[model samples]
Target: MKKHLTFLILLILTAATGYGQSATSDADSKIVTFRFQPGKDMFVLKGNETELTRLYSLVDEYHGRITAGELPIRVDGYCASRATEKANLHTAYLRANRVKSELITQKGLKEGDFVTANYATAYNGDKDVVVVTLRIPVKKETAVVKEEPKTETRTETKPEPQPTVKEQPAAPVTEPVTETVPETPAPVRPYHFAVRTNVLYDAMLLPTLGVEWRINTDLGVKLDGSLAWWGGEHGKTMKVWLLNPEVRWYLLHDKRFYAGVSGSYGEYNIYKYMVGNILSKDTGYQGSLWSAGLTVGYQLYLSRSFSVDFNLGLGYVRSEYDSFGMTNGVRVYKDRDKTKNFWGPTQVGINLIWTIGGHK
Candidate 1:
């Protein structure tokens, strides 16, 4: 009876030990995790539901391999969106199968591999779905080698003396060569700016007006105009005016001062009042005249599109018509002639400009 009792106790103890070992081993195992989302149709590793299923199978297979000890069990898993189609039953089964296959083909899993799967519901607007999670096992092993102790031995032997000779001068040493590096050149910047002007004049003795425009930084357009009037005693009156459309080109564009040429055509008009000489006190004369001219100007910029312009240039002004008459009803006749030469300085003025277009 005593022997039987002892034997029974030993068997129980052995079983308990085995159980503890198995439990502890599984508990200490390591695992790898995989995540996936849904894509259009194909199994996409990045954003695809189909790919998620495939990942599940791979994990399952890995778990099997670890359990069977065919490969060191490395923990692995897959996380899928809960919103996937067939959220519950379909997703669960699909994940299990996929995980199993993955372990076998990709990770070389075998039977008895351990795998744990979790399923959850997800709502993706259009549908309610299931997400699957998997965990796989992994194991690590290390080996160390011990080296044998070495013994020390001592032996005495006569020293051999080398023959000595007179010292000779060592050969001259050569200096190391060095390469020279070349310097890089600086980049060149381009000059950019433009100016233009247009003008119109009347054939009758009237003021001339001109419009000026500047294209800044070689990238914009500006417009402005001017007029001038002239008068003298004795009915001798003259009026010159300019109409100009101008573009400015800044040679040295410093934002403030711009040097450019202005071109314009203008009309000049004159009225003359004549007084009779001492001998012919009975009569006086009056007449009308017309002509045209061109000019150029330099501009100093004040703001982004505003400038003060100083203009001085020459242009051809032709007289179109002329008339002469006396206040006493007496008339003097002169052909309606044109003057070919009419040139002079243009007036100084400030220009307010606006730029349009070319804002990137």
Candidate 2:
């Protein structure tokens, strides 16, 4: 058993050594290395230990990122981590060099400039990768001077004196001329005329006739008359007549249409006769009647010089008799008291008109 254990131990040790050598050889052949930082103005060539040490020192002082002077730095490109054992130093260096070239050429920066850089780490499989960034500075320029402009001075010239001539006496001033114009006569407008027939709805009242004349478009005058005949108990027949005059005011004054109201006083006359009887003879009575009222109506134009008018009115009526007398061979008895008559709750009536004049 001891002999077998010794042989096995020797075999295991040889195999382990061979495996280790193979692993080391493969790593050396397949993997490459490089150094970068987040901020840098220049790139170090791959496998250049001297440049790598310089970059590392700069990166360490700036703490993985730096902005020295006016330059800006940042890390870019693909990477796994900073601690990558199998990093592609060649590709990393190429990328860094491109960044530096871009800053110098495209960004208008000087070559070999020391600029702040930023650094980062990434991992690819089991490899750590490092990146560097750098910013270029911008320079300011001074402005150029402008020359002052020269101005020219101008000289003034005086006018020459004119020769004097002997003056003749001035002619007498002429009077201003005036023009004469003919005056135009004013236009003439025709007058308006209206007539109305009014009959009370109640049986005791009489029908009335009214006429109106417009003195002007805004003012007018009215005249009215009424007549009635009545037969009562004891074979008595009565006749009555009333006349009224009024002044009117037009409320609206449009050319073709108008409306107005009027105030008027009425005069009435009555004649009455009674048949004969045994105790009293045929008797007669005569009186003057009075009435007062307001009227309102409108006028409509049928032509330039003619128009139609309509009106309605309400008023009170009263009759007074001086004395009573007998007639037609009848005996009569006269009372000492005089007779007075008053009638009306209201009076309403309308008028139709035919205007003759007053044209606008």
Candidate 3:
């Protein structure tokens, strides 16, 4: 009994050693691994590269071997946990597909040569990797058949008739019903034209008219003109004409506050009625001024179609003046001519605005 037990133990040890050696050899020969950086669209071949070359070289060598042996291949893809399982699955699928595409296109492999699978946050334990494996076909063992001598025996039995039950009818079928859905309306854009009058200038009877064209919610341009003429007995006469054009950029989408620049050109005439208490007909100085300025302002919307705008301007003005006197209502030019240059507040406006075609 002792001799038989010792022989059985030796046989078991030998078998275990042989199985371990076989498993190690199979692991070394069958599997090749490469690591990948997480959250990247492209695969890096150098992740498990050797010095001065890449594991990509090993892939090429394996490709040649596969082509020679006509072996099947598999690509397994994995991704770390994403916000949702579907996202992880999709990412892993995309990575596997990308690898398969590169293998077919760049490595000159046939599209039919590879199959892909996405592990999806599994197998890698929360790390991202793509594994390319060459599949080894399993060999099936042949079964041995044992032959035996044939003998025959026969027995006779009588057939009997059986009664059958009738089948019941199925229930009536109903069509599926679909629910109606309401349609959504399209969005409206805010664009329009507004006409505004400067009421402050109206106090001076200097009717000022402004037209603003708002191309968008936050950008606009305005053109304004003011004209007035006054004449009295003692040769007291004044005439003024002004043209101002400005570009406005609203700071808010609602167009509450804005800053812009303007260019203005104006001409005015001031006449003195009497020269030394005697009516000299018309003695006056006519001057023309041009200015360019920076402006800042705010608008208070009173209603859907009405608003008030208050703006201030400061800039440099250049003016040229010519003196003249009139005899028999005809103008006569004087020898005195002057030019002036000054910089200060150039404009103040309080305007009442009415929107014509703009949105609220």
**How do the predictions measure up, each by TM-score?**
0.28, 0.32, 0.43
Candidate 2: where is the Cα deviation over 4 Å?
1-190, 195-210, 228-236, 253-286, 300-310, 314-318, 322-347
lDDT of 2 at 278: 22
* Tens-digit lDDT track of model 1 for 220-250: 2333443546555554444555454444443
Q: Give the CA lDDT, 0 to 100, for residue 229 in model 3.
A: 82
For candidate 3, which ten residues in a row score worst on lDDT? Answer: 182-191
Prediction RMSDs, each to the true structure = 27.3, 47.5, 24.0
Kindly indicate the candidate among 1 and 2 with the higher TM-score. 2
Per-residue CA lDDT of model 2 for 137-164, tens digit only, reads 2223435454444444444464654444
For residue 68, give model 3's deviation from the true position in Å: 65
Q: After TM-score superposition, what is the CA distance of residue 284 in candidate 2 from its true location, in Å?
A: 9.9
2 or 3: which has the higher lDDT?
Answer: 3
Comparing 1 with 2 on lDDT, the higher-scoring candidate is 2
Superposed on all Cα atoms, model 2 deviates from the true structure by an RMSD in Å of 47.5
lDDT of 3 by residue, 1-360 (tens): 999999999999999999997665543334444456666645555654541133245445556545454665677888775667777777788767756654543344555777678866765464676677754544444465544434343434636534444444444455686854322222222337889899988776578998998876668899999987878764567688999999998875335789989989999876762221132434577889999999999987555578799999999989898878767777778845688899988788899999875344
Among these predictions, the greatest TM-score belongs to 3
